[model samples]
Target: MEIDAIATAHAKRLSVADALLPTPPNWDAAAGTELSVRDGVALATRSRVDAGSPEALWRPLTEYRLNVRLGGADPGAAFGALLTEWDQLLEESEASDWDSAAVVTRPSRDTVGTSELLRRGFAPTRVLAVRPADRLAGGPPEVPGVRIRHAEPSELNTLVRLQLELRNYDEQFGVLTRRTDEERALTSATRELLADADSALPSLWIAELYGKPLGFVQVEVPPAAGWADSYVAAGSAGYLASMHVAEEARSSGVGSALAAHAHQLFDEAGMQAVLLHHTLANPRSTPFWYAQGYRPLWTSWYRRPAVQG
Candidate 1:
């Protein structure tokens, strides 16, 4: 195990490139160690080396996985090297008393090389792609007695409540990714954003059927350069942060209505494209977005080894 800093400039570059690529444990950045496994697999496990108790390199791997958040690094060569090294190390380590081993990696075009890691000897794994949804060229369904309008300050709480219930976001990604206080803060922040007069900021759109709240969609304005740069650089445009519809209203064209309304807003604004990520693991969303005509631009995988495998 090599915990010390890498001497070679390229090795250091690998570390920086890894850092640049978005991973889960972002703010928890810390000093990392390069450890050797059974068959010469070199695993780079990181820890908050500056914290009070910085555990050993293999400690977290044994207990729980540290998620990788893909930022903007080209995983083509760096990730391939990481996987190859780890595979070699694992083969050598399997003969020892060690029960299991795993490595964090982003999925690439070469699915064959990735699958071989399991065939050759790695344990249980997964490949999840984060799919983005885009708007279609059309208008929403004309639900009788339903009208779309700009969200008002008075409807802020209602919007939050509807979003919590309709999207099941609170359970799906919110609770897992945010604390109770964080959720409350997010709700308030959205309301404040609605009241702001910044033209470059995102806008919140509301849908009402027979004077009742049907759903809402939020669109960030002026466009984000970091995330949408690739799509936008090639002439793609806009962003859809969050969209939700009431439970009873879903599948009744309300979701499409909200999306179409957003498309109208984008078209009016002269933007051509919109981008937003959805968890492929989510059942309701996978098909919903597909029906809306949004295709995947890229996919990110989450891999974990079984306890005994």
Candidate 2:
């Protein structure tokens, strides 16, 4: 198909989808500004890296993202054509030594894109969730000897250690990809937080028992360009960037206490909702986040190793 025709079709499909969304995305602008022809289909690509890691040897990654509208006169055929083109692109990427690729879509009960991705070996890797800040206003559950407080600058090393523990837990479920010089990466992240005084980076909360930190939760204002921001009204969203509780502290209310404290912070800041992403493959994360009042808004579909065929 011609590139102009493909772009027009994709734009129409996106407009239909956007009208159904709980919060309409700026698809018109995105289609006009970022749309391009690839393998005879309209699409876009973005290159990214695990910049938080300190390792120098790791390579950058690329995402061959498609924002095309799926349905048409013959929806199945249209989807099949796009998938065939995508497979060709993937083969080219493997030959070029690309490390990985990914796609993001709004969660839907059934769609041509979702079905085709599943048949092509893609799997759901992450789920983005959102909840109103007012829903988070209840007092934190109490646990004896457990207290939640802002992390002190003197305890930077301790915070890093706790984050490393969280990383270890996430690694088990393939949630984390970048693994290089963790201490250095974590130290850099901590320093960045400290340097951003106007933001909530300093609002890192520690769940402690007798002056020893057992778990932590970090909240921050979402970036203007983030996917979550599209769904949130201006100045009404906070990102729950990270939350972790020690294994021994699990089911003991430490996690709840930390979450409650985070809610309090967002509430005080006048945020109307909180947004976060978690790996669906993690057994612990799915149920826990649901219990905390989060619901999925978007799903990330992925394929790893970028193998050539």
Error of 2 at 89 (Å): 1.9
Candidate 1 per-residue C-alpha lDDT over 207-252 given as tens digits, one digit per residue, 9 for 90 to 100:
8877888788888645442355433222446677778888778667
Name every residue pair that clashes in candidate 2: 133-272
Off by over 4 Å in 1: 1-81, 84-135, 166-175, 200-202, 224-226, 230-233, 304-309
The lDDT of each candidate is 0.49, 0.65
TM-score of 2: 0.79
Q: Pick the candidate with the highest lDDT.
A: 2
State the TM-score for model 1: 0.59
Model 2, 1-309: lDDT tens per residue? 565555465546545644323433335444322432332343545455554534321223545565554434555466656666666765655534434555645444325556777777777887777767678545777778899887777778878888888777776554364456767878887767655667644557789975678898888864632445565444568889889888877887888788888877777877777888888888987888889887776677766544434
lDDT for 192 (candidate 1): 80
Query: Which predicted model would earn the best TM-score?
Result: 2
TM-scores for the candidates: 0.59, 0.79
At residue 256, give the lDDT of candidate 1.
75
